[model samples]
Target: MADDETRVDAAEEKPAAPSDSDLFRQSEIAADYVEGLLDILDYDGDIDELVSAGRPVVEVVGGRLQALVGQRGATLEALQELTRLAVFRQTGTPSRLLLDVGGYRANRRKELAAVAKNAVEKVKEHGEAVRLEPMSAFERKCVHDVVNAISGVESESEGVEPSRRIVVRPAD
Candidate 1:
């Protein structure tokens, strides 16, 4: 009887996954926040709010939007965090919101894929670990995905934020 009660209590303590509707609501809130920001900045763009891959995604497509992307997508990352905060304020729950401006993330993903491949090649050739420059969490994930797909090499992140980087090593 005690074991049954404990099992029930543990199940109640586990948080339920957000439904698709909830994810869509987060995207809508994020889109509204981004639209207001674009208006303030006097930037022209079309914002799309949707749920993709179990997460909320807000994409802004427009011309001359490099300013929003900033150096190495720094500005875009900041905007994404702010938008997530806005969604949290309204929904009282944290959101995994992906905000893309001018297709920066897609382009960067391609670039990171190439970089990861090159690092893997070096590791395989020399049989030594290759240390890559520091990158954001998104960038690191991109590299990890690429490296993980390939054989004879493995990847791991080292150090801390803004200084953390991927180290590709020969598979043992």
Candidate 2:
């Protein structure tokens, strides 16, 4: 009986998953932060925030917003971190906030997916490992997902941030 009571207590203590409303709130906070940033930079853009894939995403669409994306998306990554900090300050919780400018990430995802598939094909044909160019965490994750879905090939990241890359090879 004591064990059963303890088990019940543990089950009751488990935290509930965040509701969609909570996710939307986080997105709203992040959007506000991004909007302020765009205003400060004197960049004109339309900002939209919403919850997707269980996380908050803020997208900025405008002509000539490439400056915000920076080279290799470095600036965009930094902005995402800053936006998440803003959300954390408001909600007292760390946020997985995705910030994009001028549809860069959407286009990049499609490109990376193609790159990953090509790498997979190469590994399958050559029976050897193939190293890909350095990519952002999000980019690497896209490749990882694509490679993971395929059989007889595996992908892993090798290096530190800003230089980290994915290596795809035979599963064995």
lDDT of 2: 0.92
lDDT of each candidate versus the true structure: 0.95, 0.92
Task: List, residue by residue over 1-172, the lDDT tens digit for candidate 1.
Answer: 9999999999889688899999999999999999999999999999999999899999999998999999999999999999999999999999999999999999999999999999998998899999999999989999999999998899999999989999999888
Model 2 lDDT per residue over 1-172, tens place? 9999999999989576678899899999999888888889898999898999988889999998998999989899989998999999999988888888999999999999999999999998999999999998999999999999999999999999879999999998
Worst 10 residues of 2 by lDDT: 14-23
Q: What is candidate 2's TM-score against the reference? A: 0.89
Q: Which stretches of candidate 1 lie above 4 Å from their native place?
A: 1-8, 11-13
TM-score of each: 0.93, 0.89
